[model samples]
Target: MKAKVVALLCFLNLCWLLIGGGVFSALEWQHESAERVSFEDTRSRLLQNYSCLTEEEVTNFIRAIVTATNAGLTLDNSTASDTSNWDFGNSVFFSSTVISTIGYGHISPSTYGGQAFLVPYALIGIPLCGLMLNGIGENIGNFITKKKEQYKKRWSKKVSDRTAEVLVMLILFLLFLVFLVLIPSAIFLALEGWSYHISIYYSFVTLTTIGFGDYVPGQNSAQRVVYRLAILCWFMIGLSWMAVILNQVSTFLTDIGVKAQTAREERKKKKEGDVGEEGEENKAAEDEENWGSTKSAKQSNVELRNMTPIES
Candidate 1:
C-alpha cells in the first residue's frame, strides 16, 4: 500500500511538471519568438552598417560576448575593470547556495578544475545541508506539536483535537507568511527597487530553490555586506520552514492513504465474518431437521411392530 501511494505521488508530480511546462511554453513562446526576431534584425543591421566585418567575424564576436556574459563577466566600462567575481563575499554566497541546493544561475564556475570540483562539492554538501535542514525542521515540528497539545488540553471541550491541531497549524502558517515571506519581500522591494509583487515572487522563488536567475538581488556593486548576510540567514530559515511544511503535507497524505486501506481491509474481514456466521446457522437448522425426521421414522416402525403382534 505504501508503494502504491508513493507511485501515485510520483505520477501526480510528473503530471504536474508536464502541465507546468506546457503552460509556461504557452505563456512565454510569443515573447521568446519576438526576442529572437529582434536579435536577428539587430545582427542584420550591424552587418549592413559595418561592411568590413564579415559574417564569420560577427558570429565569433557575438559568441565571445555571450560566453563572457554566461561566465558572470560585467561588460560595463566603468566598474568592469575593477569588479571581480572571485571576491570573498560573492564566493561565500556561491558556496552557500550551491550546498543548499539553490544553485542560482547568476554566476557559475567557468574553469575545468572548478567545474570538476563542483561535482564532488555539491554531491557531498547537498546531503550535509539536507541533514541540517531536516534537523531544524524536526525541531520546529516538535515545537509545533507540543504547542498543539497544549492548545488541545486547554480547549479540550470547545475545540476537538483535530480542530486544535488545524488551528495551530493555520496560525503558524500565517506567522510564517507575515514574518518570513511578506516582511522580507517588503524589504527586498524597498532595497532592490522592485515592485512589491515582484519582490514577493523573488522571495518565493529563492526559498523554493527554483532560482530562475532572472531577478537576483545585489546586482549593484554598492550593496552592503549586511544585506548579503541577512539574505543568507533568510534562506536558511525559509528553507527549513519549507521543509517542515512539506514533511507535514507528505505525512498527512500518507496517513489518509493508510487509513483508507485499513478501512477497506476491515470491511472485507467483516463481510467474510458475516458470511461465515450465516453458513453456520443454516447448517445447524438442516441438522435439526434431519434428526427430527429420523426420530419420527423410528416411532412409526415401533407402532407397526405392535400392530403385527396383535394380528398374530
Candidate 2:
C-alpha cells in the first residue's frame, strides 16, 4: 500500500511538471523568438551605423554587460547609487530570500569569496529558516484544528467527522489564500504596476519558493527599503501559511492510503477465515462417512458368520 501511494504521488508530480512545462513554453516561446529577431536587427543597425565596430567586438561587449548584470551590478547611471544590489537594505532583502530558500535569482554574488561564503551561509540559514517556519506552521495548524473541532460539533448531526473536517479545511485554505495570497497579490499589483495575473503569478511562485526572478518587486523604486522589508515579512508569513496547508493535504492523503491498506488486510483475513471454516466442514463430513462405512462392513461380516453353519 505504501509503495502504491508513493508511485501515485510520483506519477502526479510528473504530470504536473509536464503540464507546467507545456503551458510556459506555449506562453513564452513566440515572445522570446520575436525578441531574438529584434535583437539581431538592432545589432545589424548598430554595425551599419558604426562602420569601425566589428560583430565580434559588439558580441563581447554585450556578453560583458550580461555577465555584470547577472552578478548584480547596476549599469544604469541614474539608478546605480540608490538601487544597487549591495546597498544595505537590498542586501537584507537578498539575505532574507536566500535563508528562506526563495532565491529569486534577481541578484547574486559577483566575487569568488562571496560565492564561497554563500555555500555555508545557505547551509546554516536554510535549516534555521525551515525550523522557524515549521514551528509557526504547527502553531497555525493547531489553531485550525481547534476551530475544526468546534465546527465539527456544529456539523455533527449533518455530516461525518471526516466530511466536517474537509469542509473546515477548505474554508481555512480559502481564508489563507485570500489574506496571504490574493490580497497580497493585489497590493503588489498596485505597488509594482504589474497586471493582475502577473501579480498573482508572482505571489504564488514566491510563496511556493519556485522563484523564477522574472518579475521581482521593488526593483525600479529608488526608495524601496520599506517595500523590501514588508515583502520579507510577507514571505515569512505566507510561506508558513502555505506550509500548513500543504501539510494538511499530505496528512489527508496519508490517511486515505492507510485506510485503504487496512481495508485490504481485513478483506484478506475474512477470505482466509471463510476458507478455513469450509475446509473444517469438509474434513468432519469425510470422517463421519468413513466411520459409518466401517460399522456397516463389520455388521455384514457378523451376520454372515451367524448364518455360516446352515449355509454350509
Candidate 3:
C-alpha cells in the first residue's frame, strides 16, 4: 500500500512537471514572437529614417550591438578604459554566481576565451561547492543531534528527545536567519543605498538561488572589490546555512513519517491479533457446549440401562 501511494505521488509529480513545462514553453514562444515583430518594426523605421543603410547592414549592425552588449562590452564608450563589469570584484562575484548556480547575470564574460573557461570552471566549481555545503550541513546536523542526546541524558525529567531536537533546530534556524539574512540585508542597505525592504528581498533572492536579475549589488560602487568579496562570502555561508536547515527539515520529516508508519503497522497487527483471539474464544466456547451435550446423552443412556425393570 505504501509503495502504491509513493508511485501515485511520483506519477502526479511527473504530470505537474509536464503541465508546467508546456505552459512555460507556450508563454516563451508568445513572448519571443512579439519581441521579433517589435524588432522588425524598429529595423524598418531605422532604415526609413536612415536611407544610407541597407536592410542587411542594419541587421548586421543590430546583431553586432546585441553581441557586444551580451559580452559586456560598450562600443560607444571609447573614453572609458575599463568597464565596471570586467573589474576584479565583479569578476569574482560573477565567478561565484556561476559556481553556485545563482547566475544573477548582471555581468558576464565578454570574451570567447572567458566564456570557454566558464564552462569547465563551473563543472569543477559546482561539485566543490556541493561537497562543501554537504560537509558543512552534515557536521552541523551531527552536532545538533549530539547536543540533543546530551540534553536528554542530562535533564531526564525536564526535556524529552523530540523537544530537544526541536529546540536545536529552532536555535540553528534563528542564528542563520539573523546572520545570513537579516544582518546581510542591513549591510547591503547601507552599502548599496537601497531601501531596507529591497535589500532584504535581494538577500533572500540571492541566497535562495533565484537570481531574478532585478536587483544587483556593487554595480556603480567605487569599492567594487570589497563589496563583491563580501557578497561572495555571504553567498557561501548563506548556502551552507540553507543546506543545514534543509537537512534538519528533511530529517525531521523522515522521522515523523517513520514513526507514523510504525504506529500504523502496530495498529494493524493489534487489530489482526484481536480478531484472531476473538475467533479462538468463539471456537473454544462451541467445543465446550458440544462436549457437555455429548456427556449428557451418554449419562441418560446409562441411567436408562440401570432402570431395567421399568424399560418395558
Best by lDDT: 2
The parts of candidate 1 lying over 4 Å away from their true place are 309-312
Q: Give the lowest summed-lDDT range of ten residues in model 3.
A: 72-81
lDDT of 2: 0.90
Clashes of each: 0, 0, 1
Ranking by TM-score: 2, 1, 3
Highest TM-score, which number? 2
Candidate 3 per-residue C-alpha lDDT over 1-312 given as tens digits, one digit per residue, 9 for 90 to 100: 488879998999999999999999988989999999998899889999999999899879889887766665546565235655766666777888888999987667757998899989999999998898788767877887788677768766777777877877888888988988889889888888999999989988998899987788876677777777778878887888788788788888789889998999999999999999999999999999999999999999889888868574
Model 3 / residue 78 / CA error / Å: 12
Flag regions of model 3 displaced more than 4 Å: 5-69, 72-81, 87-89, 108-116, 146-160, 303-310
Q: Against the true structure, candidate 1 has what lDDT?
A: 0.86
lDDT of 1 by residue, 1-312 (tens): 468768998999999999999999999999999999999999999999999999999999999999888888788998678877778888888898899988888799988998999999999999999998889888999987788788989988998766776677678788788988899988888888999999989988988999887787776637756778888888988999988877766776677678788999999999999999999999999999999999999998888788865575
Each prediction's TM-score versus the true structure: 0.89, 0.91, 0.74
Per-residue CA lDDT of candidate 2, range 1-312, in tens?
468768998999999999999999999999999999999999999999999999999999999999988877668888766556787988889999899989989898878998999999999999999999999899999999899889999999999988997898799789988998889899988888999899999999999999998888888865599888889889998999999889888888778778988999999999999999999999999999999999999998988888867695
Local distance difference test, each candidate: 0.86, 0.90, 0.83
* Candidate 2 clash figure, as a count: 0
